[model samples]
Target: MTTTTIERQRLSIQTNPVDAEFQQQLDQVFTEDACALLVELTREFRPRLQQLLAERQRKQARFDAGDLPDFLSETKAIRESDWQVAAIPADLQDRRLEITGPVDRKMVINALNADVKVFMADFEDAQSPTWQGVVEGQVNLRDANLGSISYTDPNSGKAYALKENPALLIARVRGLHLWEKHLQVDGEVIPGALMDFALYFIHNLAQRQKMSTGVYFYLPKLQSHQEAKWWDDVFRYTEQKFGVPVGTIRATVLIETLPAVFEMDEILYSLRDHIVALNCGRWDYIFSYIKTLKNHPDRVLPDRQVVTMDKPFLSAYSRLLIKTCHKRGALAMGGMAALIPAKDPEQNKAILAKVTADKELEASNGHDGTWIAHPGLAATAGAVLNKHLGDKPNQLQVLREQDAPVTAADLLAPCEGERTEAGMRTNIRVALQYLAAWISGKGCVPIYGLMEDAATAEISRASIWQWIQHGKKLSNGQLVTKQLFASMLDEEAEVVKGEVGSDAWASQNFERAKSLLLDITTADELVDFLTLPAYDLLP
Candidate 1:
């Protein structure tokens, strides 16, 4: 290493400028002891993390060569064994309605006071992770834990603060694929997951103590049991370093990836000491469905809108998950209801009906709880789950084991729907607008009455790319091609411009978003994620 890189390894990565108040919070969060823990983590586990990521690329190569992911033959013994995860903490028992948002200060305050069962402050898909967003997210969570977070709107001159009995708080860290580029150790970027976890864990020491509830987490996008083990080790290591009990840090894993679906048993087994549940991250699961099977022409999915929870493949996935999780004594939480409360009265009624129906499907399928993106959705979703749970804290006893109809074929079954021109156009428009907002440092944006985050954006572009790759014909009988997508993209950009108006079109990063989206959609090879390239746009 160079002299400067070596010297910097001994020092902490400096943060970008924020307001005076946030700078003070930053100083408090990054004490001398905290920096030491960060550097120690970087030195010890960074190599193993890289090895695990390399294994992902290796497995994908096998899949591209016509190998399919199935239950691991080697670990069949573990799957058949009788075991269960550690007990669920009292605070996380009733997660019937959980709301997730980016870790902005105002959002943190609002989500905490939203009267849901849990408010998941997200550092993953929902967070843009600009230097300001990352720094302020930590600051906001610390203050929220202390019951002192507040916000005063500059535009509306309105004040906001947490309510007396706020929802339970959980921090969802970034996936293994993302690196926090703002910080480096030994001339390399640090894993964003580690950064979020370390900072959140250390800063919330008081929160854990004062509430007598150990730090809880929501782990995202883990593709295999090995990744879950990595996180489990990190949790135990952090607990040991802090001198807390080994199982003090509990977590719920999002089974968002296709490979992860087949390994639910192994994943829970690996993290049994520190895990309580497995969530059905439906959007990312759909994105993974396309990405993992991209080379298989017969498996090209239909419209994004048609890929709802009730579809055969998705229902099978959910049923199998409910059976697996409950059998293993873990909660099977449902997916996000991304509907925003529309302003039009009739439209809002339809949206509520949709959200309610979705939660009903989950509750009936034996999911213990469900996720909602908007606060207005809590009442609708909670009522349905409440009816299912009666007075119980959760639905762990509602196991669907006896009448289960899911099989491996069900999980990988070809999604059935028409590939319509309107669907293709909708994907282009949503992806363009969401990417523009993302590059402009807003990770979560409402487009066309639904919350759009990285997972949904990934589904949009990946679906289009897969369709074009296989030369599939749309419902309108036009073969999807690069030229056609480019044409649709141009038209949709104008449509978005007209809809968002010239001021927004002129002010935001729409042009940059358009260029990136077009390049990825028509590229010869499929890109893994949109955010990897978009992260360069952030400071």
Candidate 2:
């Protein structure tokens, strides 16, 4: 709002500057006037983010003392009272299938043209958080919104363009825990969440409104309703600043953290005016459960593959979400189907069958829709939901009042499967490969035929830390000690090096990825998050 900021549109936000071409794309979306507005907004919200993040650490310390999270006593009335979120718009009502990917121009174009009902343009876990990647992602999103996005591959001369009828677009910003070092307000870095949200909301709100489509979002990594309240306040401030109507922005909170599961009702109430749905972020939720209860030996989870939706803890969590969302007249979305279709007919058939079974369970249990990471599997997942929700927008009307009540213990059910050296080695391999790709500016990568993202990488590394912290015994009775893990990590790094070839290993960020993996997994004290140190590694 200052005259200087208004007069001069360009200012310092990034450590490394972009060239004329890149700056052109940035200035298109981030005009001189808009940059001034963003600076003011960041100054207003950054302090609240810091306070809430500190609150997160305090809550973690309490958890370390064997205290568990429960429904908030202060918000008990909000939970028990008879109330519902604002009415959902038509385009958002039937989200049977959603495809998620990074915000690269080609990826965005393909995802929009995919067969899914919604495309979650991911800027959080699916992005590298580099200055170039973050700014270019905004450029791509702004172009996609105008229906003028396209790409031509230099290697193959293949052209990609938007289809006649693209899927609805919903942007997922960075979580509260991250910061954008490029943008400084009073010499303090702005929260990456604010940067991503403000850029998209400011750029696309009017166009979306003119098209009668809601400017939607996927809110990630919310640990408490208090955090949700902060986002609600941000929405209100943004609306009032632009003279936009209240409730015009819709958000789906990803219940990915342990504390969030217990506060589902309170979180919905906090953002009730703009809440549209709740998504089961299964991978990160598992990662959170491990980290939140890291001190307890009995709560240590089995292999990642064994912790399926059918498992007791996950089943209880998903059931509770469905019940809670339906009771409040909001949509309940199931977790992502991560398996990508294979080249071999037999393998692809099995993967499709699994996707169908997962989506069927979600629909039968009153979930409104589900998510798929690949376009090929959309039909499989969508068909199941379509069968269950024939001639209906969603299953919000199908109240599962007879479902068993969920207790705290049920939500904390212990793992029952075997913990083997195979699982341990798998985690090490995945962490190295995924982190390498992430460091090389590809946050979403397919490893062993499955699409992997930051959540998967977090759990992979965190699982190793937890296994070592508790001195877990494998099925063959081998203890997971530091020495054993170190030897295995070296072997896995070699394996990845050979798999990716010597040329790629030398050039494609393998060194930093290996170093970060070793540093985080082997440290005496667990690192807060792998991304924090990894972000510093970016140019």
Candidate 3:
């Protein structure tokens, strides 16, 4: 067989085809010395993959059979008057500063005082699952009571409460499908009835306290566009039952699934008329990637730094998302800036600077808002956003800029040997992995012998691009050009061609890589910029 054919075989293995003919060919190609080992591994993996596919088929069948309970029906069964009510002030949407406080303490008061857009009082990921904690969190939010509530650290036993202006609040609720019993530390099951009661109680309290309008929710883990549609229907039913306006209750769905990416158009259409926006979710997305591609151990995630947006596939995906939201005339908000290092002052400053730079890029790219997990980070984000928003350009101009054409030479700019090189390499690897995985029809695949799947590709690409466009760079060195990057990709492809055959694996990987490289080539000017002579290192 020719060298290209060998490379194809390698690609086929990475892609994982179930076709008997392909298997036969692969078997024929294996050497006697390693044939048994490869066969054993294949034997072990095939059934597991089959099982996963079977499970998916079963779940889809259940859905088609209408076995999935209707959340709207459940929500509508409750009476509107049974919950409390409040009018959402018109000015709430126009507020500039937004604050999210972990505990409802003085945070709400601070937010209100600061006149922020939203005061998010998180419950799902932030607070303990105990009923007492839920009740307390509700009370603090409902009453806008930021004072006289002290929290003791479970580990350190240190106690503290807010003494200054509290942030305005929105609450994040537990997913309707997540059972408290499953999360209990004491092994005690919390009944469904209790969970429902808690939801209603909080809903009622918010209404009664006249906190209706800004009393929004952060919905978690919505798996499909259909799920968003269900939630919209539920919202409509609940509002009518409660005698509230159709759009009174607002929500942002966390887009964190592979399926969710395809369902984006549907999801937005489903909630377009309702109070809904998309929030890019990272951690859960990573978890989902792992779960979806567990059989491909070779595609396991590497270090966090390795994943970023400079890679072609991810950059395209993220841009597509932003474009989708913008097309719908809705907010295209950026994902969480969790990687902002806050422990070390210098590191925190550098990360904040990077985040600031990113926000500018996002806003420039047409995103309206972004997220920051911590109070400190929020302040930094606010500053960054405020600076960008201050100079917010006309929509027409932005669109024109977005539509402008560029060459492959522009997109492949070399990274000056500084940290940027590492960043670029990371982005390239991630992009290659994503292209390999998606084109191969496998949920995950290995690149340069490392395992990577869809989720990793998405997050890494989003992040890396954010860095490339916004991260700090040196001033003196020559930047890599798009032509150079194209050449680099060509070199990589030639290497693969020499190593693998034109079999299923090589075919899929090469096609995917070509598509991704073409995407990058068409979009931006890839050029390496000069590195600065001296730069302040992040601690």
Candidate 4:
């Protein structure tokens, strides 16, 4: 058989080849040997993935039936036990400011070269899982770790390259539920999360070890300690298969989901040997909050704007993260300040002040570090964290035991505010704009002066569904029906078409974005995630 045909056999699926040259590169990454290993790994853990996902649905049903989440009683001893995660490595000691962005090649370079202590290269929320996008992102990260990544714009002739003293890299792989449809092993498509994590860990381990920085990760969407344990098992198996030390791979778990927030201690304990911190994945946490309690009328959230961290439930979640992490000698990392630096001086000044206050609260409350979405906000976030982190790697020393105890009521605090027509219109606009960008293979977009990702879009659509499901009405006494949302979407489409001009508006992607947004928003039943359906539209 020809070499090209033989290579296709290894992938065991009919995927359109990017080109011979690119195919060769992919062959190297997904060689028969590598595919065989991944097949084994997938088979080993696929059942657990199924169970965990099923558990998620089961838990959701209970929530829908009026049950509220609380601390896991079965894991009480694990939480009450006196134990701490493994020691933090020197390179990961001070994560004062971490910048997050997609795994796009230019973005990878910019984020690494940005002035932050750590740059989380996201393969989950900030990236569309196109075959090219998924595979090329791996190649970019591989080159970035080796200091050989660069890009030149074909038209503008502008160039990008990594600078000296680049931020340490952390990879955030996809969650358990998503899978790559392009490449299959024995007719089964590989889990996208495994593909992302395995490809990075396999390729970059040696380079990072040579640099002595280690392979760090950010774990996303974990709903239970058992899920964390599943990841822990995966880590163990990966290290054993690769001949690395057991705890060589360190990860910071994102306490984003409502169920995850309740099991913080248990989650930490489950991955104690390979964990260094627990991050407040705030954007998605808010989305998950709405998803978890959507059945309860009283739990319906107000305008997303008013659901700030100071709100009862969010405040409790934030403080509890700090107290739990500090007590266990782990870092309590804060969530993203999603504001980008605006051109208007007054607006930028106001946003900076707000970020400063947020960071100050986290620092004073014993957080070790925080996240900034844009490079410009890094310095501002750093300044606040530095005030508390001065001369010390982290505030892991500050045991927040005296902080007010966070109870189940605190975590499930009922939402309080007005639902306005302005809010509904805002959600419609942002969701459409983001969907348009995402369908165009851009997962991260700046809309209305804020950097948004899949998490933001998730919140946008999930909130709409909750509003419609619960028959929420705006201050104008209008019910949030599908027709109401579609009408606003139509108006927003015209506004966007005008903003982007006729050339963009007439494009196929723009049309698809509109159709996709309408489908998700106005569907009879809520779509679990917009990305799942959107993934089918990718090349």
Candidate 5:
């Protein structure tokens, strides 16, 4: 009987049919190199994904229960008057210190604490696109509460209490993708939460009891005049829907696109009623340059260490932007000084010195203010502002002298003839290099041996092209024939032969010649050269 008894086999059952199927799929599809990834997918990702789904469900449930404050309602409470379009005080506008807060919470608190005029809490480049993080950020900004944290100088060990300043806290929201992500749950994009948050914060702030000045937004990635128009429409719709005043939402569009460079006036006009200022986003602009010039084999982004503001194309473009903004009666704000190192004291000091010099240059060139990307950089901004504003430019001077109206015709103004053929040819060379770069999609090109890596190819090309396009029209009172222009281009191409090459000799010499041309040409000479009608054509 004992001999007849057999050991019973213990059975193991696979309870997860999905896991089995997933493993089978992996085994069939994954190669050896991918097997590790497959294992991670099943073992690590599945559980994390499940956890994320559960958390999302919880958040949705809370949202559905109306646990969150209604954004539209809050916005309605803030936007009661003509607060949106009220002219920013010359003092505030003239106050050049711009401190960029790392996070919304930090930015809001920093704005509350710092003496800088503009405090931007970034959501575009500075943020991680995590769902919980974004939601919490929105909530924190919407609530406009930064708990009782002491604002202190890390170096000096000085602390101060930060009071809330409605006007100073500029909330930079997530771009469209993150915004969409924020509203989605289980793959369904429900914009109720995001829209609610935006509407509540903007509208309510616009309509608040003290009617504290309307909160501003820093608009990023504006690609065209149409993009600016789109934001304008969104703002209008949001305000109207919430019964917020028609123009209660104000924004500063970062001109980061190649198209945006040419359409600055158009974009400004489109958002004229709603825009507070125009910011030149340098890094993004550089990135755009790289993308636009991807087809060009000769141009590569110069090493970052070599890039500097003095490069011919960069200097020219910077000047052009400043002039254009001033002509429009809008603030021409300088680009971000984000290179400041927060950890290294010496690097910080050197950056501050450069920043001070830059701000002086910008202020002299008519930029209203510049950007600072850290709390530590606030002192740099403060010093520059104090020095520049110590003897403020007479507001009457700014108000009385109307900026010369720039028309399509003005874009074609020719350089006055008071120079030698060499000088005129030099100007033409600079203009041609810019045009080639533009057509090839580089926003800025480095002049070898002169500027490290400062000039933007896009800005140079746009400025030069605008002049050429407008000049052609003005010169002949009609559009120039492309065939006729092509002939001139061919001739010039021969004269400037080997200019577009990757060889070190060709590259170095070309840049050197271009830089020399920029140096020798006078402002008037350059303008005249830009406006000069096609050589074969007569004025």
Candidate 6:
């Protein structure tokens, strides 16, 4: 944290690290040849990554100027033309239910052992990317693939290890926007996505090859087919660098951004050689809906709670994604059902029922699989998906070409619901607490019976921003303004303190989190990702 330490660390990118144990592990993971590979990937891909990011700002500028995102005219031929993605590996087929969590050792073991088809060890939304956390994640995943991972809880004296026939592991790297601040290749910090992809791919490729499983990934926060192409390039380049076949690196892209939905076909085609599926990242998609359409009054969203996947816009998005992916010979995966199990039996039953209904909807609509956060809900999702799947590995044959045609209007429909003061307070509390945890080295936390992560917090904040920008009125008839939002935030911070208790509040990062929330929520310009500024505070 000292200036001297910063300068020393800044100049020692491929050399020593601050922590001795971390440095030692880094030496092993970033062996002489591995370091050379990272350097090459970073230098080659970083330029195109910058250009793509710049293009995003340009596109957003147009959107802000009242230009709506629609299916691209240039990609029409690609969309209408006959095409299909690469074959799904045997292990990726029949992904009835996948559990996702941060990549700490215990969570990795438990999630992999969960009764699901895949466990996405998330380095993006579900993880707080501290220097130690990211490297430790690499070590954990390396051990996991070798079937040597084990953990004995220091608090409970319980040991955890992988069970037979564990869920297939898929690593979700950080989004394109994030950078790995801890390590620099040359004078600049390398893209976090590149580091995550290269390290995990290189470290685990041998074992994966032995198992004939290949290396699988979940690509997040893409806004266009061009971005998808960037990933495809990385996959191809890495495959070549490692002397593996081009198809050895497979990905399932998350159509999480508003712009991405319009480019699904092109995205699938771009990565067809490496892509096997597309997932409805509903939470970030909602956040992107608000962020991308912030300037349009007609597109303003309702409460975070009421902006469910059942909404017309979201329903249409999912239906369209299913049609597109299935038409292209790829599995159309559903979004997350992020409800944690409650302690009360009745409450837990209600939670499971919600998950069941959600998965059932996805299944009936022809999705191959669904995502659930908790291991407890796996059986519920599995049973529902099983009924639809029957003996088939996937619902790729259920191509909903016969369903009513979806258009841009359907995808941009205004979300229907009432905006209430209670909902605003809930948003305040959720973002405040989520930010508190995020800055304190945890990205996924359970709050109020829901498993919350960066995406949910994003929806909460972005909805508030869009509502205020458009001078929205709550059902209570209070006009939303900066003063009103500030007053409510002050009140909600107290409510959170009361709920979480004063002692814990004083010890935790709530105050710093509150200042951050207040700054972003009431800023004149809508800030992009809250993680950008929060990343600066990470150790």
All predictions: root-mean-square deviation over Cα? 2.2, 2.7, 20.3, 2.2, 19.6, 2.0
Candidate 2, superposed: residue stretches over 4 Å from native:
1-11
Q: Residues 1-539, candidate 1, lDDT per residue (tens digit)?
A: 12111133264464554578766766776677666778888888899999999999999999899988788899999988888888887887888889999999899988988968899999999999887788789888988999999989999999999889998899999989999886787778889998899888888976778789989899998999999999888988888888998888999999999999999999999999999999999999999999999999888899999999888889988998889999898999999999999889999999999988998999998999899999888888888999999899888887775775566778899988999999999999999999999989999999888998999999999999999899999988999999999999999999999999999998899999999999999999899988999998887
| Model 3 TM-score on a 0 to 1 scale | 0.51
**Quick one: how many clashes does candidate 6 have?**
0
Per-residue lDDT tens digits for candidate 6, residues 100-196, read: 9999999999999999989999999999998778888999999999999999999999999989988889999999999987667667888999989
Q: Count the backbone clashes (under 3 Å) in each candidate.
A: 0, 3, 70, 0, 31, 0
Overall local distance difference test of candidate 5: 0.46
TM-score, prediction 1 = 0.97
Query: Which residue pairs collide, candidate 2?
Result: 9-32, 13-182, 13-183
Best by lDDT: 6
Candidate 4, residues 411-505, lDDT tens digits: the string is: 99997888888887788778888887887788889989899999988898888888888899988899998888888888878888888888977
Could you tell me how far off, in angstroms, the CA of residue 217 lies in candidate 4 after the best superposition?
A: 1.2
Alpha carbon lDDT at 206, candidate 3: 46
lDDT order, best first, reads: 6, 1, 2, 4, 5, 3
Instruction: Estimate the TM-score for candidate 6.
Output: 0.97
- Cα deviation in Å at residue 483, candidate 6? 0.9
57-165: candidate 3 lDDT, tens digit per residue: 4654554343321223323322111221122244333323344444344444444444334565655433323333444455555445424455566788766555454
lDDT agreement with native, every candidate: 0.89, 0.88, 0.45, 0.86, 0.46, 0.90
Q: For residues 148-191, write the lDDT of model 2, one tens digit per residue.
A: 89999999999999999899999999999998877767767778
Question: Per-prediction TM-score, please?
Answer: 0.97, 0.97, 0.51, 0.96, 0.53, 0.97
Give the runs in model 5 whose Cα sits over 4 Å from its true position: 1-95, 104-107, 145-161, 164-167, 177-179, 185-209, 341-348, 391-539
